[model samples]
Target: MTYGPDTVSASQPLLQLRSLSHSYGSVQALHGIDLDIAGNEFFALLGPSGCGKSTLLRSIAGFETPAHGEILLDGEPLTALPAHRRPVNMMFQSYALFPHLSVEKNVAYGLEAEGRGKAEVRRRVGEALETIGLTKFAKRRPGQLSGGQRQRVALARAIVKRPRLLLLDEPLSALDRKVRAEMQLELKRLQHEAGMTFVVVTHDQEEAMSMADRVAVLNAGRLEQVDTPVALYAAPRTRFVADFIGTANLLDGTAAAGGILLDNGLVIAADHTLPSGAAATAVVRPEDVALAGAGTGTLSGTVVDTFFLGGTSTVSVQVPGLSAPFTCTVRAVQVPQRGSQVGLVIDAARTVAVEDDRAASRPGAAQETVSS
Candidate 1:
């Protein structure tokens, strides 16, 4: 399989970062981040605010120079290249469309800067507008279009340049939920059709999970885990990833003979043998724990709350051993009333053991491939 320039594949590294580190005075932002972004992949850098996700994206875009690192795009060192000289384009959070210019002119801005022939610019701009489904809106100005349309115009402008890599910083943060959802699919379609690598930096977990092929979860300037959304959710590698990726019941426990012994002395069967008597935590997803009729299961708790969410409802059960009530997902039809007793049967096969890394857990919160 030929890669780079002609056709790209998962085995081909289009963008690679090695020993990337950045700091702001005494505060370290990124600490030795190494990533290999495959060709034509939709990759996401996810983390909360101030976790250096933005800093990392900026470094790749040549906006912020890293304290130490190297960025290579298709085997070419990009760290030394200026933002304008690099074969990349960054669509900022604000869209940054020129309100005074027509949509066609806005889309033609990048080509015009490079001094392309007028006819060539027009042809490329027309193709980009058509690709982004904005051909009819070409004559309209930014203020004349809706929020989503304006975003498309900005995207058209970026793609018109035919950059090898596109860096989008908070690409959908400004749109409403419905528009954001629509744009998510649209972005995926656009990326697939274009066959260009996209590195999206986002704090929205839902956006990242729903859009990208793989997600790199970051926290406090450190790499937490890089995996597919399903793996990140079902098999988190650390406590921080478990807490940030999805709703998790982190029950403090001690590693003992059979399993991790909870505060109430209940043992949750674990797949790995932990250091005996070491302090640990059991990470359990809400959907993984099943609640049944009381006295018919291995564990029991009193229903503290029930959240009705269309097809499924979450049941929060207050157990004596767990600090926070364990949440179990049940069909909306099976939601029990609050204050009712229920039994929780955990599927041991779904549970994974990892180090108790709560110190990395903090409220912080992007896409890849058509298929690999």
Candidate 2:
């Protein structure tokens, strides 16, 4: 499926950041961040609160100045331009619609401020309303519109200017769960139709994975990983990335000849190139774990809990040496009873071994990736 505009050039990036860094008093909010965004790609900045995603977005939108680094748009320096002068628009989470103005007028506000002629403003306003599917509601005020409709109006206003770049700060956080889901699809469709580059900041992992062509995960004011959603989930580069992007069972162990040797003397076979005796983590997903009859798999454990989730059930198994229970996803009909002894069969091929981040901090330590 196409995740971005149809005609994007591969040679040159539309936006570039060179060692971007920002600080708040003594605390650093953004480390030296370097990123590139294609012309019409939908990119997401994802992380937990205080990860500096919002600061990065604000820096790009000219709302905040970076302490170090340069911002470039289409290879043009943008550090000197003020927010109002830059050819970019930001959609705030609040939807910021004027209560007194009609829908068409709200969308036309930017064009009017630019001193466009009356005929031109009328033409653009009509087209913008039609683009957002609000043409019939042009006469109504923001107070009369639904939350979703107000969001669409805000989107219309942002795109009506035909800015070179569009920034969204948690645009869907204000909507309910159902409406938020519906709007995620709507946002993708709108991006494709508008054919403009979009950069969204969100703390929700699902939202970022669903809508963005590529995602940059941030942690503690630094970028953990930047990749496509599939790659980010399947082959996370760091322990932080593996844990943050999805639900992963991180088995801490020492790297042996061909696998990770857990403290309990269980050697989980995995594909990795780490040096022998190095600290490593085995990343396993719940779906890759299978529950077999006792003594028939790698390790045996007692089922402590079972959670039924419609088509599937999650069985939490309490092993002897592990502090946290190992979770396995099985078909609802195949769920075993609690307290039943079962063997945990891990899929070796699907497993990944990543160097422990803590180990990397030690002197003379190195990091390695899982081999194919």
Candidate 3:
């Protein structure tokens, strides 16, 4: 297929970072990060608050200099280019709009700085506003717009100059849930329309999963895994990824011929082979845990907590000897009442085992995705 500049796909990278590393004093923020973005790809750098997602984005944007590594755009090294000289634009989480300027003026700011003729600026600004469905609000200031509208104004400003790449830092964090959902669709459309690479840094897992073609997960200044959201969720290579990307229940047990045998007299069949005497932890999502009749199941427990979410319910069961309660996510209609006796059943094919290297046991080992 033809790539950028009416050339073949083998021409060059749209954006490339080679062995990028950054540090603040003695604390390292990013360590040897290598990534590439093809033309028009929507990529996300996702991790928790201190994982340095934002730091990496800033480094790529020229806001921060890396102690090592190189940054390239359109196959050209960007080592010597300043932020203003590089063909890149950033939309900050705060929607950094000029409160005093009208929406049209804000959108035209970059074009004006480039000394474009007035008529050309008008044409580009008009088109940008129309593309974002803000043509009528062009005369309004940022103070007159809602959070979502202001965000749109910022995006229009960034894309009006036709930058080669766009960087967004938590661009949707300020909007309400409904507005955020609407803007997500808008951002996707905008990316396709501009036909430019869009790299976003977010702590929100669902946001990253919904908008990105690929996600690069980081933790404590290190790259964990880079893959599509489905693959990251389905087959996490490390225990941290398995626990961080979704709600999971980790059951510590002794390795056996079939699987790992729990201290509670329960055995989980896993896919990987482990030393017969090794201690392993079984990772299973709450949604995979099924409830059955007490006398006909693998393990039995007492229902202690039930959350009646719309269309579904999350129930937590207390089992003896386990440090924390085991939770099961089931349809609201399929759950039993609180204080009732219940049986927990796990599907053999869905569970995986990881070696537990920390303290032998801990209470409430249930894991959750980031962006909370």
Off by over 4 Å in 2: 1-8, 359-372
In the range 1-372, model 1's lDDT, one tens digit per residue, is 111144555566888999998766656777888998887889999987777788889999999899998999877899988998998889999998888899999998888888999999988888888888888988999999988898888888887787888999999999999999999999988888777888999999999999999999987777889999999998888777888887887777777765678777678877766788777777778888887888656579899999999999999998865667888898999998899988999877777667675554333221111100
Candidates ranked by TM-score, best first?
Answer: 2, 1, 3
- Model 2 earns a TM-score of 0.94
Backbone Cα, N, C clashes tallied per candidate? 9, 0, 0
lDDT for predicted candidate 3 compared with the true structure: 0.82
Best of the two (2, 3) by TM-score: 2
> Between 1 and 2, whose TM-score is larger?
2
Top candidate when judged by lDDT against the true structure: 2
Clash total of candidate 3: 0
Candidate 2 lDDT by residue in tens digits, 1-372: 222234446887988999998777666777799999999989999998878899999999999999999999888999889999988899999989999999999999999999999999998888778878999999999999999999999999999888888999999999999999999999999998888999999999999999999999987778889999999999998888899888888899989877899999999889899999888999999999998998778778899999999999999999889989999899999999999999999999988898887634421112221110
Candidate 3 residue lDDT tens string, 238-349: 5677878877787888787788788978777887777886877788888888999875565678999999999999999988778888988999999898888888888778
* Index of the highest-TM-score prediction: 2
Candidate 3 collision pairs: none
Question: CA lDDT of 254 in candidate 2?
Answer: 87
Q: Quantify all predictions' global Cα lDDT against the true fold.
A: 0.83, 0.88, 0.82
Output the worst ten-in-a-row residue range by lDDT, candidate 1: 363-372
